[model samples]
Target: MVKNQPCIEIFEIFTAKRLHWVVKDKGESWTGQYFRDIILTERVFPFLKNEENVIDPDEVIFINDKAPCMRAY
Candidate 1:
């Protein structure tokens, strides 16, 4: 892994697969984070395109890990 770059652990990736979403055990391992209801991947392109520029749903990893919800345009 390169310095400062994020690396997804093998275990997290596997668990995320089973859950059908991206999983993140951030801050506390016991309490896991789930994202997108489904796995975070290229398929989420539509959702990302309509959303804010800074936050990308496809890039999102954890459930609780999120930015502003319900953008008012």
Candidate 2:
């Protein structure tokens, strides 16, 4: 990682035999609002919409380890 060069964050889903991933630009620090609005909306949503992946939106589950930026207060 380089300073001020913009970093990328990846969100991945693993099924029994396959993996799905979404990549997005990351900021210096992640905030709860930013995580949802940018990462979830811009990256994850579009990735989930790819028909080739055979993902069911209703069956999708999101899990985070209670990172500060992922909590809703």
- Return the top candidate by lDDT: 2
The candidate that wins on TM-score is 2
In candidate 2, which residue ranges exceed 4 Å CA deviation?
1-9, 15-18, 22-26, 66-73
Off by over 4 Å in 1: 12-24, 28-73
Which window of ten consecutive residues has the lowest lDDT sum in model 2?
Answer: 64-73
Per-residue error at 19 for model 2, in Å? 2.8
TM-score of each: 0.16, 0.48
Error of 1 at 11 (Å): 2.1
Q: Write the per-residue lDDT of candidate 2 for residues 1-24, one digit (tens) a residue.
A: 577775577767654335767665
Compared to the true structure, candidate 1 yields what TM-score?
A: 0.16
For model 1 the local lDDT of residue 53 reads: 31
Clashes by residue pair, model 1: 34-63
